[model samples]
Target: MKRLLLLGVLLAVSSTAHAIVIRHDVDDAKYRVPATEFPALVDMPGEGHGALIAPQWVLTAAHTLPMHGDLKQVVINGAARDVERVVVHPGYRTLPQTLIDQAMASGEAMLIVVFLASGDDVALIRLKAPVTDVAPVAIYSGTDEAGQIAKILGKGATGTGATGHSPSGPNRTELRRAFNTITSAYDRWLCYVFDEPPQALPLEGVLGNGDSGGPVLIERDGQWLLAGQGAWKVVQGNVLTARPGRYGQVTCNVRVNHYRDWIERIMAEPAQTTAVG
Candidate 1:
């Protein structure tokens, strides 16, 4: 069995952002997409990404928000939208620094996995005004997420699976789309492996730095549904030396269906005080 190390790719202001890493044989240009293609995909604070699930609500990962203050605004439809409020799931909690340090020092992979799985990694942003130009994506409520082919969109760092993520890649801000099949589904995570060559999709890839809070979408009845939120990457062996965004690594996204009720309840509320869990 392979030991897995769960690492968060959450972007911060001073850090560099990475997009999807593609197959070495494929053209990098093939992965690029127009910004108009994914209008619901918005830019979150700290260079993270989010999807608009409702006209007034944007769904994202809680960790992407600042630790000190409320996320005051987000870029939606290429325009800045004032945030009315932000609500992180009450069940969400960050692992203590002490425990994380211990896990890293002891090389205990399961300790990190169990702690991450136990927490809700989702959050919702309420916009002061409802967006009418771009249609919002619906949350996938079905239980059949495993084995589904998902389309991941991001505009961060870029590199090939053969080389992992490169810090010197050109213009790490182009919107790109890649495909991957969900290999496993837990109550809180959807895991997928990055395969090379014959086993990989024509444009197979995985998220890199700065893609946290991005959407993993599945098509249903000609409509795209939000199935997961980009959260963490699982690397095999010693995490300290592990090169992320490479073949054989796993990308685990926050399973969206598990918190559908929580999303609905928060959206239904007339107003919510800004809270971070």
Candidate 2:
């Protein structure tokens, strides 16, 4: 099992803020989403979440996909399957050597590098066989997700801080979720800011480590559509003036509508895939 990197929290200031924040209780039955609706990617040893976007395809964050080349590394909801192919966005770039250098020089933790590499962070995993039992989620092709009610489901940790482990553990066996309204919708990203006062608490929740690659869903009529995938959490503290005001945390996702064509193209492409190792 590849040791999973902490998924959320990209800090802009030198001082450390609490890592990802998951508001629900670890075993809150109400927050748990059934495996049939959204299967947890047990690969990466339960590092992240993935949605069944098609009978044979799963959607996830590019950074969270297993790199060990062994298809056995990934087990979706206990059903083992080979990775037939993987399609990372053409524009996706993991931390470059240059960025690592900068991070090292600045005394930033490795996770900070992820915040620097945000944008086009989605990927599609082609499984060996079609998942006939699980229904695929529809991707939203509409204009934007701003101001829309969104639901995020994942098997990530539940708390804030260094040992902010979710009662669910790293490989959250049961998927949990929360509801929030989209605050900003850019051409390529959707975000939720967490600095609002308590009155706005009901309108939002935060993402935590291990929530990466999970789906952000929007309901259309009665069906839930995939609006985006959890990508990075941008944390900008008071870097200047030295007086740290209330910490600002932005939970961001790769907007699905902006890359609908690209997703279709990749899925249709010949299986010219590479091993994660």
Candidate 3:
């Protein structure tokens, strides 16, 4: 389970691998992303990816943005969008770089692990201009989605690697999609296990660096609902043993269902809706 332990340790790895698609045998083009779907790709100015949830609002992982201050500039799919407001989940907490450094200095992986699994990594970006052209995906607010198939989209690494091993090269720049079964669903998170090479599913993949803030979508009765956002990738053990080349990586997605009320409230507030950044 990627839960909290794996996410904490995986964050310590090099950002070059950002996110991954573990099976080298998979075709990258077949998973080509729709031009109008999953529209936010924070390739430059910022590092992670994102998705549009409203005409003028974008949703992503909080870590994708700077700790404090407005995002002066954000490029989504080549077009620059000024961020007016940033709303991070109050409970979202990741081990800061300074804390990570302290943990490394003291060899305290447990402390970092405990902090990373708080399960609140989501954030909302109010765009300066309305993105009315692209239709926003509806958020999922129904029952538990365990065992359901979901699509994970990103512009991450296409190469495969084990848990404790580092990627052999830089991550791919093209947008990609992979399918995974929701192994488990917690109150605030959804977990999906990425299969290793010799994949059981033709489209099975994992996450690396640039994949953060990407969308995890679920389809129901022909409607694709936004269920979660890419947060972290984890292996079973801690940094010392959870090598990338090792098999079994669990990808954690911040569950959208648990925060629907908060999202709705934020969207409805006009005062917090200005494009200031």
* Top model number, TM-score: 1
Better of 1 and 2 by TM-score: 1
* 1 against 3, candidate with superior TM-score: 1
To one decimal, what is the Cα RMSD in angstroms of model 1 from the true structure? 4.3
* Best-performing candidate as measured by lDDT: 1
User: For residues 65-162, what per-residue lDDT tens digits would candidate 3 score against the true structure?
Assistant: 76456676667656777777788777766556675666445544654545656647777888778875567778887667788888877765455543
lDDT of each: 0.74, 0.58, 0.63
User: How would you encode candidate 2's per-residue C-alpha lDDT over 1-277 as one tens digit per residue?
Assistant: 1112224432331111222343332334445556565553333444666677777777777777655554443566767767777777777665555644554455354455345345467777888788765567888877667888887776665553223343224434445666777888877778776544453444245556666777788889888899987776544432112121122556777788887787787777666656231
Clash-forming residue pairs, model 2: 67-276, 67-277, 158-166
Name every residue pair that clashes in candidate 1: 18-156, 18-157, 19-156, 19-157
Report lDDT (Cα) of residue 146, candidate 1: 88
The CA-based lDDT of model 3 is what? 0.63
Query: Which scores higher on lDDT, 1 or 2?
Result: 1
Where in model 3 is the C-alpha error above 4 Å?
A: 1-19, 32-37, 40-44, 94-99, 106-108, 161-172, 197-199, 237-242, 272-277
lDDT of 1 by residue, 1-277 (tens): 0112222321101011346778999988888888887899979864568899888999988767766676889997789999988888888776566755665575445556566667787788888999998999888878888898999888766778886764333324878999999999978888888899999999898877667777889889988799988877765555444456778877888899988888888788767665543
Candidate 3 structure, TM-score to reference? 0.81
Worst 10 residues of 3 by lDDT: 1-10
